[model samples]
Target: MPLVSVRQNWIVLLVFVALVLGIGMVVGLVAAPGTYVRELKMPDLVLPDAVSGILGLVLSVAFAIAGWRTWVIDSNSTEMRLWLATLILSWWFSPAFFIMRMPALALCIVAALFVLMVWFEFRTWRRDRPSFWLMSPSVVYIAYVAAMTAAIVAMN
Candidate 1:
């Protein structure tokens, strides 16, 4: 059996979006006003928070598209699970970095995760050449993370 049907994939994606929005609303309204201000002190050269957020959202959508394509082509592949897990973990790294105020640690974690993602993508591509393009969004995400890390380092 497939990991998730096409319809189920859409449902999961919708649910993920809803969860993110709900969390955002809670953080914006319920959390202390200065919560984020205290946690994230980014340099001016880095993109503004809103712009970086939008970029992350766009990149996430791209990853979703890639995941959907992978599901359509071969939902049973183990790589699909790895792709999904990597997506979820990628979502965590930003909060983990900014909220924890540990750029060096976060950079190390991100680097490790990037290596793992690349390895998974390579395995998937080797097993199924047709799905090679699915890796592009993952690469973009890694690049984004790297840029963020560099900006954080430059700030100090």
Candidate 2:
């Protein structure tokens, strides 16, 4: 790889950003209600919902940025293949877990997904010197996933 040729692709970056924003909006619309206590009623509903929505938005954006960075920079980097696969799997699992309405199963899936994400981050960090701009989003994403998994497990 020539130093001069490693030019950043703004178009790809923008598309990735768009994907994150779009997915964030969709996830919020679909999964926002589930944040509240379902089986056991919580004392305060409004705060939970608001907090959840903000969390959702933040996670959604984080995922979007991570995906875009992965795609744009490591478009064909084999080192990133595992991370890419896990990210896609996590995304797919989300819908499946929710559609089935099985919190226990969703928890399992999310837990595994979080592990994979951690692995992905580890691999990425080791293979390349990703900037804070790239690494921060991935960290936030994993945290969000963990929080969501906890919330869902509690519901179950």
lDDT of all predictions, in order shown? Answer: 0.62, 0.56
Q: Mark the regions of model 1 whose C-alpha exceeds 4 Å error after superposition.
A: 1-45, 126-131
**lDDT by residue for model 2 (44-156), tens:** 22246567568656755565556555665666865356555655665554554555555567666666766666666666665544522455555565666557666656654
At residue 59, give the lDDT of candidate 1: 56
* Candidate 1: residue pairs that collide: none
lDDT of 1 by residue, 109-154 (tens): 7876787677666866766444446566657668676777867766
Lowest lDDT 10-mer window, candidate 2? 37-46
Q: Which ten residues in a row have the lowest lDDT in candidate 1?
A: 25-34
How close to the true structure is residue 35 of candidate 2, measured as C-alpha lDDT? 38
The alpha-carbon deviation from the true structure for residue 135 of candidate 1, after best TM-score superposition, in angstroms, is 4.1
Model 2, runs deviating above 4 Å: 1-8, 31-37, 40-47, 92-98, 131-133, 136-156
